[model samples]
Target: MLKLLYNKKASAALANLSVGGRLPHAILFEGPQGCGKKLAADIAAQYALCEGEQKPCGVCSQCVKVERHTHPDLRYFTVPAGKKEFPIDLVRQLRQEAYIAPNEGCCKVYVIDQAHAMNASAQNALLKIIEEPPAHARFILLCENRSMMLPTILSRVTAIELELPTVEQCAQALASLRPQNSPEERQAAASGAGGNIGRALSLLETGKPARAMADAKKLCELLIFADRYQPLEILAGYDKDREGLLAMLPLLKGMFAQIAVSHYAKTGRDERVCNRVTPAQALDAAQAVEAAVRQAGQNVNIPLLCALMVERAKQALH
Candidate 1:
């Protein structure tokens, strides 16, 4: 069964394409990371090759193969590990492959993961294939941003934009994925991840959410009153795992969000448990951390992100 969260606009639009008996030769599934662009691309590929009366009837051979990544007609390209960009030569090879007939289906589906990773040269190389795709060829370009794409490339493909899922939605999805986790634990993990299911799952599976929360809380307290380099010293623990570092930022945001929430309570809340900082300060700190995370996605160096984040948090909280 294929289920997605918080992407109704794209669902309705893509559904219309299949129901109306027309499918585009090239599609750009543009969205932030972990927003299910790749998942939607997989579903579209299966829908195109499904032979059943209802397209993407999951039990069909085509749908099953796509699910298992065993489909002969589906081709996927991604930047190899340690490579920052999708090489231009790969695009040239893909252009050659687009003309070939499908091994078992009506069309050849090429799914490009992280099209933003395709530098200018690589994107220019891909421009021709997308501009004049073969009759039996379909392309899905999974991207975090479309602004990086060439205007010529943008003009040729159907664009399916996806937005982030809500915290409640992320929590619900986490419950299904990890029934072993208690509802409270799942909710905590979900909130800590700021509605990114992939990050929440990473935190849960590695048993790092609780640890990250404790550490982030400590860092916040230290920022309120500690040595100048203390916050950076704490951040150095996450140098080896980028995802752990990523999760730490949101969990820290969650901490400040809690502070913001508690700051407004009338009389009964414990200010000690939530921090003594004003709501405005807490909110400012949260926004700073968010900005740092955004920069990290744009290829900011990890050391710089850590230094910037620590300094920002210290300034806002202190």
Candidate 2:
């Protein structure tokens, strides 16, 4: 399963554990969304259940069952949608199930995805299970942001940080998935995905890459031209989708960085496209844009954020 994609750090960690017998009973895999944390956890679970001397032998009955999500000892949990928190009752049920002997394997594996979504009470309830998990039980917690989870939960588990893949790697992986797409299409998808394979695939699945790319391109033009009219127009595009606006700010900042780098490389020094701006102007613009992106995560008003970004970009162009 590790070979199915490139996760060098996780692959190496698992290999080292298999050889040294230092594997932890509980683990927390943290990373940006759509980077394949769940896939890695599934691979680890299969390794734990493999019967032969070689773990995760794809042909082994245990591995096959796990692959099919039919392994009796493998349980999965996730926070339900529309609810702001995981209920304590769910954690209590898992704790009860943890003590029962594995019906078909040497270990019982529980994977809890979106663990950060758990509220304080639910987290505390799960903390007890982590503190004294059954001898044959193993738990894997997956979260997009470790900081959102309780420190007590973090302190008890071996944490693995997954990073977004490089653009080249993401392009290659995405190309394989879209066998019919042209090279240019694949490259565009990869760039727009920003190293997230799941997001790349999602864009492909929704047939939204073309639209997303168009939006990104327009955004770039607005930043470059310092058009006073563009921000209001952009705000209209984002007004109906508050959540999308929050996600898009980082992508815009990244695009601005790319533009700045290109400008620097070509000129050997920063020069404002518009009259009277300085290198410091460009730097300040980038920093302000990025800060606004971070601030959006804190629930700042979207229109206000967009207005600030436009004003900063215009200042940089002066």
Candidate 3:
């Protein structure tokens, strides 16, 4: 069984198949970063390789092997670190290996991370095996978004979308994962990460992301309630911190996005910003933040970039 606190829809869909004992030959788990796609893929692989009567009884040897990544029949693949995309050569090799018999069991489970990073050629090569997979083979693809996948590949697999949990749920989850941390610390991390478990964990491990998010939220509040000069004070703080600026820009953009749609939807902590800023102004601010992110990546002068971002955000209010 898949043990997950959030993404109930995805868990249920995969759980239903575990009961039939005939899982999909190819399945894709799609969600944003920190949304538990990898965890779901591992659970699905366990379900395929388990020998227990109830399917993926997690205490069984087969399940333990999968957890330890020592199972001979379970294969894992991902793009080489520092590389932009999966090479066609690796995909061809994977396709060839899909036909080989399982080493330790009747079923072979292959879990591929960052499947969306495969280029057209690599995706086409992968399409061959998924199109006509061996009877004993099962493939699990993990990606942030399904839109990056080729249409042909998308048609061949079952795609499950994993949703992020709410802030309270994320805080509750952190209690179990990081028992040493105080409840207040966990709640702060969860709020800073906007309910992303992976991001919250990263924030807890290193205070940088949490610091960036805190500054970003303060800037948003200033932009909404105070004069333009007050926000510049916050922006100038990031002038010498490139990494912090890079981290904070996306969060600022995301907050603006939430503000833009808050009139029609629920946006949790951004309700104050939504009430103060109109949807049009919020959207323009989001675009300005996006431009600042691009400029930061291009080696722009950090101080000049920060000043320009503040100016643009001020203009967005008009």
Candidate 4:
């Protein structure tokens, strides 16, 4: 499985567990959204079920069943569609299911994606089972942040933080997935994706490398100008492509940070591309941009927020 591509730290952790036979009953995989935490959990589950010394023997029945999601002992839990929280009912059902002995594998694996989305009551219900899980049951709690979870929950399980793969690794993996693409195209997509493999594949599939790069360049230019007209243009463009705008937030933020640091180094004082301003001024501009980003996440009118951000940027520049 692609889990073999896990970063060195995560791979070493798993290897240590396998060799020492000291795998925890519950493991929390915390990382950025597309960093392959779920894949690693699945690999660990397969290892737990493998009949041979090496795990995830693709030919083995257990491995096949786990991959197919038909394994009686392997249970998967995720937030319901369109819902922001994991319902207590799901936790109760899982509690009942956990008691059942493994049907076809040596261990029963339960994978909870977005575990932080569980409400307080749901978390409490889960805490009970986690504190005293069945001998054959194993839990994988996948979260983007540990702070979102209860302190009690955080204390029980082992935590594994997944880091984004290197650009070369991301490019190689993307190439393997899209063998039809030219090497240059694959490389461009990988670099544009900014270490996100899923995004890299999406960009490749949709042939959006040129558009993404163009958008990034334009955004940088707008920041450099720090003018009134450009913010309106950016806002209009963002309104026309909300998804793309949202996807580019982190990239824009990174660029601004780089500009801030470079300006500081060059001038011996904090300045960003937006203006020859103090560090605090640049930070204010960044924060304003971040607020606009948060508004976009709330489904606010992108154009309106963009306009507001542009006005703020103009003020900061002056």
Residues 73-110, candidate 3, lDDT per residue (tens digit)?
Answer: 99988998899897888888888888899988769998
lDDT of each: 0.81, 0.73, 0.83, 0.74
Q: Rank the candidates by TM-score, best first.
A: 1, 3, 4, 2
Clashing pairs in 3: none
Model 2 C-alpha lDDT per residue in residues 1-318, reported as the tens digit of each score: 334376789777766565643357888888888788888788878778888667667778888888888999999988777777767788889889999999989889999988988888989999999998889999999999999889999999988888788767988987777878655455556655666888867766654455545565577567666476875686567666544454455555655665556555655433444233344665666776777766665667877877887877777755
TM-score of 4: 0.65
Cα error, residue 295 of model 1, in Å, equals: 18
Error of 2 at 75 (Å): 1.2
Poorly placed runs, candidate 3 (over 4 Å): 208-318
Better TM-score candidate (2, 3): 3
lDDT of 4 at 267: 56
Off by over 4 Å in 4: 20-22, 56-58, 210-318
Task: Rank all candidate structures by their lDDT, best first, as comma-separated numbers.
Answer: 3, 1, 4, 2
Candidate closest to the true structure, highest lDDT: 3
Residues 1-318 of candidate 4 have per-residue lDDT tens digits of 435574779877876776744368998989887788877788777767777657556658887777677788888999999999988999999999999998878889999999989988999999999999999999999998899999999999988889887656887987777888766556656655656787777877776554555565576567556567864675576577665665455445545555666664755543334355555665666776677767776788877888887777667645
